[model samples]
Target: MRPILRIFLSLTVLLACVMPHAHASVANAPGANLEVALVTYGPGDVYWERFGHDALELRDTVSGEAVNFNYGVFDFNEKNFFLNFARGRMHYLMDAEPTGDEEGYYVQVGRSITRQRLALTPAQAAALRDFLFWNLRPENAGYNYDYYVDNCTTRVRDALDKALGGIIKAHLAAQAGGMSYRQQTDRLMSAQPWLMLLLDLGLGPYADQPMNAWSESFLPYELQANLRRIRVPDGHGGTQPLVQDEQLLSPNRLSVPPAQAPDLRRPLGAAGLAFALLLVATARRARRVHALLATLYLIAAGLAGLLLLVLWTLTSHHSAWANANLLLFSPLAFLLLRTSWRARRGLAPTRFANGVVVLQLLAALAAVLLHLLPGTVQQNQPWILFALPVWLALAWSLRQAAPPASFAGAASARG
Candidate 1:
């Protein structure tokens, strides 16, 4: 295979290898019930034009007057607007900052998705299924720290719990933010049984320790017993924690044992800190390995940006064709730019590297900022989060892509 093909294949293989471990984490959790919500926005002249495309025509439902067809400028803006709104709702649900203007708009919308997900039509369910399948595939989805944090899982679970809909008021009441994270955890104690089970399974690395539900804080532990079936230390000397998977009794599956709820806060937090420190040390030591590290980080950042964009598009319930096209092509171009830069510059590529990393970090922050702005200000404007891809590409390309094979030779030649 060609060198470029080799690089691509290697990355692909690494992802594939890691996914089994990732999915193993999910195995204990109940599969999500497909529930979705579709909301429409009107009363703007430019709304239909921007979002309408490929047989989409906005018409006055009462008068039957056609306003726009196959995506006009207004439709585009409207789509972007709803996405911004949905993002705000997402923030509210997750106990993060809201981006929408009126506090009422954000809260009402969260209530609405919760409501709609409960009372979804067959058509809506089908649309959600299609949307999720296409987007949630390992190739399409990005693995960010948040992915491990379970934002997507939480969002999907919230929607489905609404769909199961026992006491509507009770479910919504349980999900409302503004109370402390601990309050939310107390709610979860009574809220979603599946999530609680998943929390207890300790399938993935995060599960190996106790996670504080309210603050969403992870506390790492010194002792292994507090966690679900961790690889216990053997009496004999061994450096690594041993692998042990002992299944616990379930409330539904077996007789309920009056057991103390595991406090994993310390161990989980410690693990996260350790993992984080390890990365920091690796990065510092691997300054010579900057190119490879940059490449990996770039790929990660690119996928993360794309996933966020897709979620933005879907929640807005707009035609994502244009945005999706941009999403895929943008990263490819960024990679190509990096390849070209590396091919030309030998031994030194620090200027481009600094420019790229700083730019990507800024763009990511900007996306979050835009997500916090009010819906009215964003209604006509395109969501700013999409801009991060450009920075991501630049950073990925500029970072030392590979170790200079002959640093000594280059220095000798210069001498």
Candidate 2:
């Protein structure tokens, strides 16, 4: 299928699911006839859907109708949507639609859907439903969207907590998550190696912090797991499991995120060493060849560093701010690019190029030294062990030799 059609269908399917109907059921008291369930969807084929999604399901048994309330709603046609997304101001809203179409869509897309029937008092259920209704109001639908803190799952989490008189938050707020946000990110993104590696490089210090259970609920799967352990008031002054009963509406047929982040550090280290060796080996048999490879690496790393800098200083992508990878892929490569290009053409690099090379090398060295600091904790081993050696080798190669043909030019230039 064409990419545009796929995205359009995915967005259509994603946005159109969740609950909508709230018609008055005949002979209803509070939520006496309404049933509430937490609906969790598993990962999908696309990258955005890799994090998964969820909604609250409201079923009015008396009326034989149900609605799903999803907070993942966004519009591609909204005014300045792409602009806002780039500014980290993505506008998302709580959306409601009948539940059946959503189920069909997910099943068709090979994503799983699990429903946990929530045991809430009639009052609690009704209050939660009403709050969702209030949230769907035109003025209220727009919400501050942050992937780590206040996305779709977190919204459902907060709404559920409010309905339960804050017990969910009060109970789980103290519990530390099993993994850091970056670790969770890596686990979910493991299926996409290149994307995962890029994120590992771009992510900054904030992604390293351990999320408390409350914050971790931002993940639909985490919230699903955590809720299984929760006991809410049964309205008779006793407690019962938050999930009264569970049902798998549809089994996941697509790839699922691993329980833990994959470890690639060993292979990364090996690859880095091999690449460094390749540079050294080629440096002897082929000067222009070595210079060509060095120029490419320098250009790629330099552009990446400059992009990271833009994200940190000019963009609101907080996760990209303060990226330590900046040290390894320093923008100084751009300054050194000319000299590397010169060497590729059998021309000698200038003395000033040596200073640029030293500065770049020192920056990469600092990245490794950061691990020795008291509180430095960005998990960048893959980047360091993988990319650092390439930079160092290139620096040494630049300083250690000039093409033999450029000897007279080098002498005259020095003279």
Candidate 3:
């Protein structure tokens, strides 16, 4: 009884998580009243295999029947050990159909389905209409082809362009040899005054909703937050029950999900984190190596920060705040080195600590300026930020080259 109850509970939890995804999948479906199933096949390219999810379905509202959409599938050699095993275990709906190709290539029809009985929300219905518009534009040409392998970007772009019907310049195709995708999107939004007006009107928030793995491409976060939901005006100067987000102001968007790694590599971000950890470790050591370790740590952190900043600019066109923070610790770095120098000279840090603080402030400000500089200028050469910590250490060390306060006072009195 206990085991059975546990199994039931687990299945319940699993169903709960999947319900929303399934609902969202149908929200922007292809057809309004008809049961529609759209299937896409993936090209058998290892680099592009992440796009290889099977079929999708939508119910025919008229017939009340479940429709199976056929996506394109890779025709694997039956004799191949992996393909043979996959075929044996893979439960394809079209398994009873002929597997061999009738045309130029070997063929397999992959399956997918969607079925729900509910009135579509206004936003949900609009999304479906947009998708259907695009899907029919190429006469649904590449929908069943294994596009991820051949020309993934072109396939999606053509469909969307066709759907919009008129050359909808309201989009940014990063792969189309323009500025970076994010930058291009921002520029397009800027150019369309109505889009900006819509955004300020609060219709952008609905557009800004985050995309999951399935609907991976759409609006970026900043733009989505701007769209406003509408409250239908009343017939007699009163409101109606209808509520909707500003769809006219939003951009039509689609994005393919990037491939995932089973064994993820250590990202540069992770590397920076680990290097920060090492600096913390060095800070914990004995007095003898404290200054040396701190110096090395400061240098390492500065370089890591610069590398991260460069990568961030390339990928996101914006500098990261944390990367600039690598400079803030330079004052602390200088103080560490100064204390070590004083220890070596058999003197106390108190003798010149005030001078050290002033130098530290300069280092911090230099760091902030470098961090705030525009990417174009900084990208030309990032080594400029590194100089702050190096200079701070050396300058403060030189400035502290004097006798201890107690001895200096005694000497002056005696003289």
TM-score of each: 0.26, 0.89, 0.29
lDDT per residue for candidate 3 within 1-415, as digits (tens), equals 0001122322332343246543333323344553322223322223223233322234435444332222222333323534432222211111101111111121222211111122233343344444533342223423222121123333332333343331222333221321222232223343343443222221111222333321222222211221111123443686442212222211212223322211112332344445434433433233345456545654544454444444334332122223334444332543445555454454545646656556665756775576466542222112223344444444444344454576789999999
> On residues 1-415, what C-alpha lDDT tens digit does candidate 1 reach at each position?
0001122322442343246543321111122332222222211112111111111111222332221111011122333545554443211111111112212332332321111112333443344333333333435433221212334333343333343342222323343223222222223332344454222221211222233332131111101122222222233563222212322111121122122333434444454344334334443344435445445545654564454455445543121222321332234334433643353344344565455456545645654555466641211012222234334443443443445567777899999
Give the C-alpha miss distance for residue 184 in model 3, angstroms.
22
Better of 2 and 3 by lDDT: 2
Candidate 3 regions with alpha-carbon error over 4 angstroms: 1-60, 63-228, 232-289, 312-316, 319-363, 366-415
Number of the candidate with higher TM-score, 1 or 2: 2
* Candidate 2 per-residue C-alpha lDDT over 333-406 given as tens digits, one digit per residue, 9 for 90 to 100: 88887877676555556878888877877887888899668889677878889887887787767665665756
Candidate of highest TM-score:
2
Candidate 3's clash total is 24
**Model 1 poorest ten-residue lDDT run:** 48-57
How much lDDT does each candidate structure score? 0.31, 0.80, 0.33
As a whole number from 0 to 100, the lDDT of residue 391 in candidate 3 is: 41
Candidate ranking (TM-score, best to worst): 2, 3, 1
Clashing pairs in 2: 18-68, 19-67, 19-68, 19-69, 19-97
Q: For candidate 2, give the lDDT of residue 3.
A: 15
Task: Give the clash total for candidate 1.
Answer: 42
lDDT of 2 at 282: 73
